[model samples]
Target: MLVLAVDTATPAVTAGVVRLEGDTPKTLASRITVNARAHAEVLTPHILECLTEAGVVPADLDAVVVGCGPGPFTGLRVGMATAAAFGDALGIPVHGVCSLDAIAVEAALGRDLLVVTDARRREVYWARYSGGVRVQGPEVNKPADLEPTPSQAIAGSAGHVDLFDLPVEPVETPSPAGLVAVAAAALGSGAEPAPLVPLYLRRPDAVAIADRKK
Candidate 1:
């Protein structure tokens, strides 16, 4: 199956065209722009360029996958909205994969691995994975406050990795291929996808002016 995948849960704005057969996903083309502030500016163009490089058009995609993030509200919103627009226009199923899970999929770490990403606010969003399957957390807390676990190593945002004492993996963002790989089963089974929900573990910073005035 041909898939269009995108992620904007971190500083990297990522997009790709992928070919999935069974459980293996092969990326046909990918584009990444490492600009924390460019999610809205770069996502669509990155996606278009990826498709072009892969020699596929929007009509050729069988499904769309996006990272539903435990990330900043604005970044997650841009990615999810763009992906939904594509799925709706093409009449294809849009699958929402956990951004952390996507990072874990590519890490191939052990039962003692943890995944984390910069959640801003002097904190991080984290989850513990047992051989790539999440077993704990998508929770946010300061590095010092995170409950001590048996985590042996960590993989995620490069900026935040050094905050913890574990060995680090090179992955810094959820790649488009990793996003699709997390949804491979649903795509192959032709299951109805769940609705897109941004995993903003906390409320957004923006509030109505009336509320702010109190």
Candidate 2:
């Protein structure tokens, strides 16, 4: 199976093509740009480049996987919308995985881990994983509010990972390989993926005019 995966749940705008056979996923090509504001500009080109480098066209994709973020509204929208559009155009299924799960899947297995990503406003998006499966949160909170044990290794954004004082594994951000790996079961089942809902975790920074009058 050929899969196209994308993630903009962090500053990095990531895209890749992966070929899955049996139980393994092999990355064919990928591109990542670390610009918080360039998700819109960089994502499409990255996708095209990834597909071209992988020697396949969009229509060749068997499925699309996307990071449904606990990230900023604007950046998160870019990835999800692109994935949905691609799936629609190609008439393939689109799957959404928690952005944090993508990071967790890349961690060393059989150990407890804490995955954290920048959520702006002095807060972070975090989850606790045991043996690569999320056992706890995909919640957003102030870093200091979520205490990590000495045994739990850390992964995700460098800035937020540093805040916990735990052993850091330097995951940085979600990758196309990670996104597709974590979504493999769904892809294999041949079921229609659920709706691609953004895991904002908190309300958007902007509010409606009706709420401002209070």
Candidate 3:
């Protein structure tokens, strides 16, 4: 199965072309560019370039996989909207994989691991994965603000984290490869595409501004 995967949950905007056969998922072509403020501009071109490089067209894709982010509302929706538009146009199933799960899978950490990402406003988007199972969070806030709990390690940016106390496994950033891997698992489980909804853990900055203005 040929799959088109996209992610813009963090500063990085990533797109990948993967072939999923029996068990293993192989990457044909992938690209990632970090642009904390360019998600809207860069995401589409990256996706197109990836598909072109892979020598596959959108219509040829058996499925589309998107990172359903617990990221900031504005930055996270670019890819989601693109996924929806493509899925609708191509009439193919588009699946959603948790952005944090992708980061956790990339780390390939132990029985307990925390995946975190910058959420702006001095907050972090965090989730816990244990023994390959997501156990806690997708919590958006300062790391020190999270309830004191111990995990095997932590991955992703730790700016808001209490480094001396939290376990340190640091995955750094999310990648298209990890996102594709999670998408493959979802496909294997017979998960089909649905409306690409933005997994915003909190209201958008725009909404906050509008409320304040009123």
Kindly list the per-residue Cα lDDT of model 3 for residues 1-214, writing each as its tens digit. 8888888888888888888876567888988888879998988888889999999888889888889888887778888888888888998888888898888888886657777788888778888778978888777877567653567677776554444366666566667667777777668777755656777888776766568988
* lDDT winner: 2
Report the Cα lDDT for residue 58, model 2. Answer: 87
Off by over 4 Å in 3: 158-170, 208-214
Give the Cα RMSD of candidate 1.
Answer: 1.1
Give a tens-digit lDDT track for model 2, residues 1-214.
Answer: 9999999989999999999886578999999999999999999999999999999988899999999988999899999999999999999999999999999888765678999999999999999988677888899899888989733699999888888878888788998888988889889889889998999988888888998897
| Stronger candidate by TM-score (1 vs 3) | 1
Could you tell me the TM-score of candidate 1? 0.97
Q: What lDDT is obtained when candidate 1 is compared to the true structure?
A: 0.90
Query: What does candidate 1's lDDT look like per residue over 4-100, in tens digits?
Result: 9999888889999999989999999999998889999999999999999999889999999999988999888999999999999999999999999
RMSD of each: 1.1, 1.2, 2.3
